[model samples]
Target chain A: MSAQDLDGGSDAETDGSGEMPKPHTIRLELVDEPGQLLAALKPISDNGGNLLSIFHERGSLTPRGHIPVEVDLECPPDRFERIVEALREAGVNVIRAGAEHFGEEVMVILVGDIVDSDLSDTLHRIESSADATLQDLSLSAREGTDEASSARLRLAVRSGRVDETLSVVRDLAAEKGLHVVEPLAEGSQ
Target chain B: MSLRLAVLGAGAVGGSVLDLAGDYGHDVVAFADSSSSAVDPAGLDPSAVHDRKERDGVVGEAAPEAVFDADYDVLVEATPTTLGDAEPGFSHVERALADDRHVVLANKGPVAERYADLRALEAESEGTVQFEAAVGGAIPVLSTISDLGAPHVTAARGVLNGTANFILSRMAAEGLDYEHVLAEAQDLGVAEADPTFDVDGIDAALKFVILANVLSDGETEYALDDAEVEGIRNVPGTALDLAAEDGRTVRLIGEATADGVRVAPRLIPQGSALSVTGTQNIVQLETKHAGQLNISGRGAGGPETATAVLSDVSRLE
Candidate 1:
């Protein structure tokens, strides 16, 4: 694999106030050696990027015997390019960068005759209508005395688009005579 | 400041208020059922009036209209909730305000359906109106909003209905289906025999509508139809199971903001402030400077709701 870019981010301007740091996912090719992952991340921290998460593809190697490391970091729009360049200057194999959108996970439950209503078509319509990717789905049918069934959909929605995506789900659910259980996502006390 | 009270409507709330009024240092001078009234210039014995209501099916020899003529300081309206014009309750408030006497309410109809009219009636009278029991019974939701000066409170939401909360919490906890749990709730008296008003989300919506009306502070007025309501009847056990698998629970949550009011079954984190169990009710007030305040307690019961009614009566001058 020549390290294709994982979904590209919107890279919206933050008015140069420099207060908001957009999240970005970066994939790097690292040799299977001790201290190699650390060596790849030093450039990110040095370039003022706050590391959100680091996923090391342990035991999974490319044909070149190099491990693929995924890093989720946040930095101002102006600093992302310099961070990628700095990583390349430090001899780190930068596979992909410049995804500036923050990723948010939203889960909603749809209840009704999910199978009879064409579940595949519903999922397709949701993904096709909203700017979201249906990451996972679980369904329960023909249980208990009631004929009603439920399906829980895990959707990966980009930040600031959550409300829009939820409305899309709600509209679809209404069209199919299904019920949608949304989350009160405001942080609770 | 002890108050002379004329209690109306002989339901559990009115009975509890009559039973507990003396304990709160207020005298029940006049009491009325739907068809009868007991009036005395000095005071009336709570147990004697209750016994008369229980045995003879009438509080006293006086007619129901006789309560209006009593020289009571406040009229406590505890009538059954009626929609649209919210009659009887609305008229009761109007009559009290017209008499230039304070009015305290345990009925949600007048406030939820005719909020602006209630305020307008209060504005014209020397006396004012207070209804703490109408929202979250015994939880003091409206009092908290007024204490925080409604303007400071940005929004209000919570599990306002006891029957719906009971059914949802029971289903989630026991993994039983909706019908099964609702049957159990009805058997346990947690839900009413019909269960339509409570389970269909109308009850909770009324409370949130009241919250929106109060939080708006005369900027706008809200009624029941303004809310977007979804009930817990459609939520199956499997949905709660899926939520529990993710460490979250499904609650019949209602929200009221300046934007609008919505009541639906929402997924909330388990054991959070809003995830109250059984018939417990919670009210979460979002403030401008202060953070979210969680007031959770017995949302409904005779004495519980009566306690709220008594507090409202005490607060009145």
Candidate 2:
């Protein structure tokens, strides 16, 4: 049978030696488009990856207006890294790279004039500037105005990057005149 | 297979089930609602069952007898959970079981308040009563526990009600008090009109009763009244204060132990599984083999609960 048939069939796809392709799971933030998922999958299959399962959370929209997708695929050990690089090179926003990427999690609360300073920009800075993944976020607008609003951010960063991540958050807060309540450590007021 | 099914109630849960069952090729024979009656041989036009009065109007002709006399392979009970009163719906379940018809229960009241009577009726008729939707809206907790042999389930706990949890999470996150958050939840259709069942801990209480019965081998003698019940009515902004003070948060936890079941609001440490469980969801179960297992997902709303009921129906042989 062809590789596509084996991958698409009910039974597990096995290599020439009858060994199963090693599975890797990657989380991607894709702009909701007609063929975004198909484009993402092409890199995996073209680079010799077998599809296992995909969880495309369409109803769930990220803060960046993109859908979060968790794709599980099987590939040879050598092709795994190439597939990841290909996905990134294709302009797919890789929220997370490998299973080890979600190892370290930290939650911090940003209190102050969140709305006035543009909360979205602050979050964007935290993610891109700090090299961290925004795992989840909870925002509360008590007065429903820029003067008084707060947000709780749950971030997943690489291990040992916590301090640097906190520094970036502190810098962003300083720039926006916001207060950071770092859960792992005390922050400057 | 053109299986004939009778929808006992046309509320959010029942109506959605009818819609899906019809969509999936199941013959929804008739809709028997407490409020109204609307039955056509071609099947119920779901739009007609939107209102309770409209449902009552359509089903009035068939009334009480139609439910008992209808030829159906399965009877779905989706009425609202009533405290202590097992009437009509309970009677409906009894009749369906007596007729050897498979019964699916999305209503916790009948299972919580009248589990024993219903179980006995099922035993007498040698029929099955599936209630996966009663405990956890879509978590598969009941089915999982049953599959795991319903081991010595010592304690069951976690965020039970999504509306209450959402309000509490919002209150803790944004420093908003109970009233404001509750109003938001109501506006979002997360909280009920009366809000008593949700905010007063009764909703969690009904779920606890169902879990207790399922884990206790259908023993309905457990005193739900004895179980302590507390709500977020008096949260006092403690979660916000705690978060501000130590970066911690609070969640309304419903916990039941071998000693007794307790439903109250508890402050969970930040990053704890409980705290991480955000809006409109639930998680936490402690059993024998698994020690402590956690399952979190949507715990309310018509669509989610309806999906759960459909999943249970799909498992039928």
Off by over 4 Å in 1: A1-102, A142-144, A187-189
Model 1 scores a C-alpha lDDT of 0.86
CA lDDT scores, all candidates in order: 0.86, 0.69
Best by DockQ: 1
Tens-digit lDDT track of model 2 for B215-253: 777543454575667676745453355354555765667
Per-residue CA lDDT of model 1 for B199-230, tens digit only, reads: 99999999999999999998889999899998
**Chain A of candidate 2: what's the TM-score?**
0.45
Docking class for candidate 1: acceptable
Q: What is model 2's C-alpha RMSD?
A: 19.5
Model 2 chain A worst lDDT window (10 residues): A9-18
Taking all chains together, each candidate's TM-score versus the true structure is: 0.82, 0.60
